[model samples]
Target: MTAPALIRGYEVVIGLETHAQLSTASKIFSGASTRFGAEPNTQACPVDLALPGTLPVINRGAVERAIRFGLAVGAKVAPLSIFARKNYFYPDLPKGYQISQYEIPVVQGGMVHFFVGDQAKTVHLTRAHLEEDAGKSMHEGLETPGCSGIDLNRAGTPLLEIVTEPDMRSAAEAVAYAKTLHGLVVWLGICDGNMQEGSFRCDANVSVRKPGAPYGTRREIKNLNSFRFLQMAIEAEVHWQIEQLEDGGKIQQATVLFDPNANGGRGATRMMRTKEDAHDYRYFPDPDLPPLVISPAWVDSVRAAMPELPGAMAERFVTADGLPEYDATMVTQSLAFARYYEAARDASQAPKLVANWLMGEVSKRLNAEDRDIADAPVAPATLAALIGRVQDGTVSNNAAKQVFDALWTGEGRDVDAIIEAKGLKQMNDTGALEKIVDEVIAANAKSVEEYKSGKDKAFNALVGQVMKASKGKANPAQAGELLKARLA
Candidate 1:
């Protein structure tokens, strides 16, 4: 049995908490700029700095964006949601407490279809709430043997914390869900969806348990940005939990971090806190901010403005466009790619054919070059035209391949001119094909005689020689027709 098959006895249980930086121009609570990367104290306001009398003023944009997120997930928008003080003392948090939601959040009760590899698992949401981010701490070992710098540029940024139920099964499933969630947020015009700049971050809760056992003691892994590390970390944690169980060591419910380069090829997790040692965080409603209330009419307007979601678009691709789920998912992974695809299809007027060429040949090249769909030179319509040439036998398959390469960078220039210039137009002239076929047959008399004598391989060999002689531009239908007639 395979290694994957061998891990049958264990099942990985996981949940994810994703923190997305909202696109609002102002901070979540203060009027300071939400733009990233400015001078440390430039974006800082009195409230952000936790000054003597700087009361926090709620940014209406942050609250509205949070409501939009709630609507996007089909969640309930709480008419009265209050920001709370999450007390944690750190250099990054200037205030003794970080302003976040404790019990009552802005939104709750939503579900997102989580896909892993190919399996679709629906993960229910516990809540999605708006909160203000704390500042950053940049450590420099040289300055004071472990000194660090603080940048308040990110402090007080508007962040929507989306928390999900522990409904994930494997690492692949978690990563897939993360990606889907990221794409959805970007599509809604709520967040920029940039992970490297700390705009989007995920905290994963993972555990492993047998089919009949109670829930395993879970570990929370923090600050995972990209999907690759998410998968690696989750899988590593699952295996670690299994090993602990097998060794008769109890699994600890605590926060942990993925070193990423820990144990060996696979990484390891370190304990941040035990379940019993977890902090209460002293959650209470904020005094400076009032409960956010959104009107139903406003919610409806946002709902009307919302674009088609990722899951729905993928379904339409399969049902309406007759694409596979995989193909649909790939094309609709990003809104830009999907938009490009739809535009190209409209321009070309080929649905199924264009989808195939795009998701197949064009997408493959784009991925290999690490380029986005916008970077590709072959417009969707132009690809449809090239495929049409192949369908009409105007150019052989090999010749069409060459034309596709030219089209990829040439951006829909004349297909006929490129084909002629490249000498790739199919040679379907009966007289020309017959001469080449005859020449091949004469040169390979033994093979032709064997073909006539009932050897299938010999017939294929003769055909191959004819194809070679024609430089792979022979119209296969015409070549087969004349070759058989003259041979007989």
Candidate 2:
């Protein structure tokens, strides 16, 4: 990646705080159903409601999921961790405080390595702590004027809050890191990675300062639900901060909200409130729940269960398949895509050809139709069959593309059948191809004379004539070789 651009002699610094909702069936401390989209307060249990006699109990499944994430990131899972109550007051927070890991979070230091363009970047991890989600507040469609309602279904949902150090210099790097993280969690099957349903959310901390200067005052952009909005919000925030500093104004630390449809349905951001520090939260160990503990054997078991990671799989693709780095990376972007690529390569024994088709024609069609690789219409075996035909010279590359289109559109099923029906089979008979080449040479006498006079274009024109005479069924490579031999 090129160096991050400077704005008026200032550099942008960014860190991310991401919340991934664990795929547990019930709340972390209570047994209430963790299902989303429930009626208001329907999923909240007595403990979630902070009743007089209810006590919090830790969920084993949630803790196991957190351990899975910690292992995936190469973080140290603390043998013993504590849960503290983060004292805060909000309408949706029934208990006046949230149970979270503060001084001794479960997962300790780690790093996330990702590529922003061709440059590899690493972001250090502060910690990944377990926490419970707060209830949601809805203001739209209220019966009373200027009134809002609360839905506590998400109140006690389990979450793993992954915090990163201020290591990014641009919005692009931050988005790349977020995307990588999203893929990792989804691949691990610990989280659903659904941004639309609030399964995953990002809060970007942005600041700007002179080169080699101390860190600048930062603003937190909260609840960026989409990656596009993440990039845009960080960019807008950076510009806003640079403008403030250039005008000799002090930068303030605060929390802000991005309104993508603000300013008459355009895009802008507004300050929500001043940002809170650790002191403001007044954290203390929770008296209800005991200290969390994990053993080395448990960690080993979790690690053993993980599937092949994306990085390792990509490297294998490069070394074993002789694929370019870009092709390997693209094919391994998701688990399904990687599986599809592997199946095609194994079936066709033409790794490069399969890679090209997947990254080129297959990806193009998928993007145009807005479909995922898992939802692709053409199966891996079907694609491999097409590649095999191209390899064996049963059809030319262009003809193979036509067969592929027919297969993609569900117009035909078998590869050989489609080629036969469309008469796309290449003219591989030596005698027949020689006759066609002789006819083309006789018809293009002037072009042949131009070729003997050392004109390369004339030679190419003669090849095109051969292809045209054969109705585009003759293999271009074979025809070119035959024509050159006859000319000699």
lDDT of each: 0.81, 0.91
C-alpha RMSD in Å of predicted model 1 compared with the true structure: 4.2
lDDT of 2 by residue, 129-204 (tens): 9999999998998789899999888989999999999999999999999988988888889899889999999999
RMSD of each: 4.2, 3.5
Candidate 1 worst ten-residue window by lDDT: 1-10
User: Cα lDDT for residue 261, model 1?
Assistant: 83
User: Candidate 2, residue 54: CA error in Å?
Assistant: 1.6
Please list all clashing residue pairs in model 1, or write none if there are none.
none
lDDT of 2 at 28: 93
